[model samples]
Target: MKTVLLLVTLGGLLVLSLVGGLFVWWGMGGVDISLHGMIALTLGCLLSLLLGGGLMFLVFYSSRKGHDDEHHRGPEI
Candidate 1:
């Protein structure tokens, strides 16, 4: 059941992305990306993914290590 739902959702998103990209390409009317531009875009996407994943990892790590827990060592005097 869960697997079926996941597949359906992913399928819908894939279709939407393809359709949107097709429209964008048609609208651009053959505007081409230079090699440098393509490299920059790829690097930007990779950096964004790495930064987001690293931040999420730190959040989970801190939660598991109790760094985000409330302190109960008595209120400061």
Candidate 2:
């Protein structure tokens, strides 16, 4: 179950990175705004990083909780 969950999470992260890169590429083709392409790309990259980190942290926290619960269960004769 843990293996399956990890694989799925990694797959999702790969897709997210690709989509974010595409957005940054798309944003490159427009007329210059007040802040220009740099700002747009910077913010997009930052958002992606934050999102990916948050997802990874959630998975780790859940796994830790599951293990802790199992550990607290006393041995049965």
lDDT per model, in order? 0.91, 0.88
Candidate 1: lDDT of 75?
Answer: 75
Query: Any runs in candidate 1 off by more than 4 Å, and if so which?
Result: 1-4, 7-11, 70-77
Question: What TM-score, computed on C-alpha atoms, does each candidate reach?
Answer: 0.67, 0.42
Judge candidate 2 at residue 71 and give its lDDT.
68
| Best-matching candidate per lDDT | 1
Q: Would you list the clashing residue pairs of candidate 2?
A: none
lDDT, residue 58, model 1: 100
In TM-score terms, candidate 2 sits at 0.42
Error of 1 at 32 (Å): 2.3
